[model samples]
Target: MEEQQKKEDGLLNKEETDTLHVDQILRALNPRGRYQILHILLVLLGIPSAGFQLLSNVFIAKRVPHRCAGPPDGSGWSDIFGDTGNLTIVQGRCKLLLTDNSSVVDSAPCVYGHQYKMPENASVISQFDLVCDMDWLARLSQSMVIAGQGVGVVINTFLSDRFGRKTVLVSTSFCLLGCGLAVAYAPNAIVFVVLKFLIGGFQQGILVSKATLFVELLPVEYRSVQSWLSGCTWGFSMMLFAFIAFCFRLRSLFFQTYENDSFMDESLRWLIANGKMKQAQKVIRRIARMNKRSETTILQQIQEKLVLRKENGAEDSERPHKLVGQESCQRLSLLDVLKVKRLLFNSVCLWFCW
Candidate 1:
C-alpha cells in the first residue's frame, strides 16, 4: 500500500530510472523564473564575447595602402615624391638613380620601409608591414588563435568536469581578461601571436563551460528555446561587433567582463555523474525551496530516478560503479573518450566540422 502511494505521488518505477536528473530539478524549479532568466543571460554571454574576440583581428589587421622604397632625399630624384602625389606604384616606382645619373638602381622588396598613405590609425598589418611576401605570416598569426581554441576545448572539458564548472569558468574568464589586455600592448608579432593564442584558449574555455552550465541547468523542453536565445545573442552581438569595429578601436574596448560574473550554479548533473549524490540533492533542495516545490517529494523523486537508472544499467554503463572518492572521480582523459564508441564517433565528426 505504501509502495502504491509512492507510485501515485509521481515517483519513477524501478524499471524506468535514467541518469539525467536535470529534468526533475527543472520541473521542481520551474523553467521560466527570474532565476532562470538571469541564469540564461549569464551563461549566454560566451557566444557574443567569443564572436568579438575572434573577429577583432579583421579590424586590427585591416590592410593599409603603401608604396615601395624611394631614393635618398639628397638625390636629384627628390622630385619623385612630389610628382606622384598620393599615387602608389608609379611608372618609375622603386627606381633609384646613381649620383652621376649613369646607372639605374632597382629597390629591393621593402628594403627601405614602405611609406604608409594613412598616418593616423594604422593597422598592425601596416605597422608591421605584414604584406607582400610576408602575408603568409599574417595568416599564420590568425590561425594560431583557432588552434589554441581547439586545444582548450579538450582541456576545459576535463577541467570543468573534475574541478567543477564554476572554477573553470572563473579562472578562464580572468585569463581572457589578462591576455586581452596584454594583446593590446603587444610589442611585436611574436608577442601578439602568443597572446592571441591565450585569448582563444581562455575564450573557448569560458564558452564551453558556461554553455554547458546553461544547458544542464534548464529543462529539456526549454533547451530548444534556450538554443534560439543563445543563437540570437550571437547574431545580435555580431552586428554590434561590426558597428563597434567601425566606431571604436578593438584593443581599447573591454568585453571580457561578460565571462567573469557569478550568476551561475554548480551543475547538479555533474555532481550526480561523479557520484556526489549528497551534494546533488542539496543543490536540488535549495532550488526546490527557492521555486516553492515540496523538497521532500523532489528528493524522493531523485532517489527513485537513480534507483530506476540502476535497474536499467544506464548509469553503470556510462561510468564504472566504484566507491566514491578521488579515484572514482579521477580526471577524464582523452583515451577515456576514445574508449567509448559513440563518443569517439561524435568527436571525429566534431573535429571535421571544427
Candidate 2:
C-alpha cells in the first residue's frame, strides 16, 4: 500500500511539470542582459520612420497661395472694382464683382482653373492642384490613410499569429517602401490615395511587430520601463518628420535600406510557440553565447525539462479518461466566454475600447 501511494504521488508531480514546461523554460532563460538591449534598439529603428510616413500627408497636402486663373491685366474686374475699405484687390482674389455698390454680381467659381503661388516645393497638393473646389480631396486623402492603418492593424495582427511576426514584418517593410515611392509619382488623385492607403497599412504592421519583438526580448521586471521608453519614439518621429520631409525628400529610400538590411534573428518565444523547438534551442544557445553565459547550462535545463514532459506523457497514457477530461476543460472557445455573465460583460467593454 505504501508503494502504491508513492507511485500515485510521482504521477501527479509528472503531470504538473508537463503542463508548466514552457513557463519553466522561460524562467530558466536570463531574459535581461546586453543582448536584450541590442535587440530592443534594432527593432525600434523602424518606429520613427513609421511615424514620419504616417504624418507625412500633413506636408504633402499643405495649403498654398492660390487665386483665380487668367491674366490680371486683361480682366475687366480692375475697372468695375476699386480699392474701397471693404472692396479691395485681395477681396476679389478668386472672384470678380459686376457692380461693387449694387451687390448684384454674378458669382462664379475659378474660370479656367486656379493659379497656385507656392514656393519651390512639390507635393501631392501642388502636383494635382487639390485646391479651391477640390480642397475636400486633401482631407479625404488623409482620412483614407488613417482608415488603411485600422485595416492594417487587424490584418497584420492576424498574419503575425499565423505566419509568425518576422515574416510579416519583412514583407510589410518592402511593401511600404515601394508604395511610398509610387505616391511621389502618382499621376492622379485616385492612384495617390490608393498608394497612401497601402502605405498606412504597411506602416502599422511594422509598428506592431517592432513593439512585439521588443517586449518579448525583455525581462518581465524591465518591460514597463522599456514600453514607456519605446512610446517616446512617436514624439521623436513627429519632430524628425518635419526635417526629413522639408530638407530630405528621400525618406522612403532610407526606410527601404534600414528595414531590408538589418541582420536580426527571429524571437525565441515565437520559435517555441510555432513548435520549432530545434530552432528555439539554437537561438537560446546563441543568446547565451552573446551574453557571455554558459550555453551548456541553458541547453541542459531545456533537455531536462523536455525529458520530464516525455516521461509524463508515457505515464499519462495509463489514465486516458483523466487526460480527455483535462483536455476538454482546457479547450475554450469564444462562445464559452459569453456563457459567463461577468466574462461576457468584460469582453463587450474590451471590444468597445478596441
Candidate 3:
C-alpha cells in the first residue's frame, strides 16, 4: 500500500509540472507571430496623434503681426494718421497714434479691434483677439495643457489600476478625439482652455495605458527590442507630425484624428494574478487562433493548471483570513517612497534629470 501511494504522488507531481509550464506554452505558440506584429502596428497608430497634440500649440497660438484697425471705411494706416512723428515700430503694434480734435497726437489701445497681416483666423492669437492685453491668455492656454497632463497621469494611473488597461485606453482615445474636435470649434477662450485641459488629460491616459499593454503583450526576452521599437515609432511619428504641421498648419488639428479599430486583450498576467481564469482562457484561445496555432492543446494545458490552482485555493481558504485582509489594507501610497532614504534620494535625482 505504501509503495502504491508513493507512485501515485510522483505521477501527480509530474502532471502538475507539465501543465503549469507557462514559458513552454508561449514557446509553442511562437511569440513573434503575425498577430503580435499586427497588434504592435495598430497600437502605434496613436503615437503620431500624441506628438501632434503636444506640439500643436506651437502653431495654434502662433503670434502674427498686427496693428489697430484703422477705420470701418477701409482706410490705410498712413491715410488715418498723417504726418506722425517717428514712433517705435514695437509701440505701433499695440498702441495706435491718434490725432484728436485739438490736433494733439495721443496713444490709444486698439479700440476698433486689431487687423492681422495673416488670415484673421490664422491662430488663437489673432482669432480670439489674444494680443496686447489678452496675450497672456495664449500662454495660459499652453500652460493649461501641460498642467492637464500632470493631473491626467495621476487620475489615469488610478483608473487603469481599478479598471482594465484596454477599457481605459479605448475610452481615453475617444475622449481625446472629441476634445480635439471641440477645441477646433470653440466659441470663446474659456471654452478653448477648458477643452484643452481635458485633451491633455485624455492624451496622457491613452499613452500610459497603451504603453502598459504593449509591454505586457511581449515576452520577457524581447522587452529590450520592444523598447527600441517603441522609441523608433515615437521618433518617426514626431518627425511626421512636424512635416504635417508645416504643410497643413492649424488645419492639421482637424486631420489628426486616427481611430484605433483593434482593441487589445487584457494582460494575461493580470488576469491570472486577479484569479480571472475564464477570461484568461478566452484570451489564450484568441491568441492561439490569431497566431494560427492549435488552440486545443494550449487550452488543455491551461485548463489543467486552472483545476490545480482551484484545488490549492480551496485548501488555502481556511488557513488565514485576517492576515490577508490586513496586508491588503496596507496599500502603498506615493508618500511611502519618502519613508526610504535611498529611494527618496534616487527619486529626487530622477526628478531633476527629467
Measured by TM-score, the strongest candidate is 3
lDDT of 2 by residue, 1-354 (tens): 743453333222323333443435445656665676677777767787778777877777777777666546655444344333444333344564444464644454555556767642455666677776676788888888899998998789777766767778888988887887777667788888888889889988887777777766654567788777777876776777777766654332333324561366676666655556556656666777777777656545655654666677845544333321143336445477789899999979967975
Local distance difference test scores for all models:
0.67, 0.65, 0.70
Q: Compose the digit string of candidate 3's lDDT tens values, residues 143-167.
A: 8898999999889977876677788
Question: In model 1, what is the error at residue 137, expressed in angstroms?
Answer: 2.8
Regions of model 1 farther than 4 Å from truth: 1-22, 69-105, 109-111, 119-121, 254-259, 275-282, 285-333, 336-341
TM-score of 2: 0.73
Q: Looking at candidate 1, what is the lDDT of residue 101?
A: 39
Pairs that collide in candidate 1 are 17-308, 17-309
Per-residue CA lDDT of model 1 for 130-166, tens digit only, reads 6676666667767988988888988998898788887
Q: Whose lDDT is higher: candidate 2's or candidate 3's?
A: 3
Clashing pairs in 3: none
Cα-lDDT of candidate 2 = 0.65
Which ranges in model 2 have alpha carbons more than 4 Å from their true place? Answer: 1-29, 71-104, 249-258, 303-354
Model 1 collision count: 2
TM-score of each: 0.72, 0.73, 0.78
Error of 3 at 178 (Å): 0.5
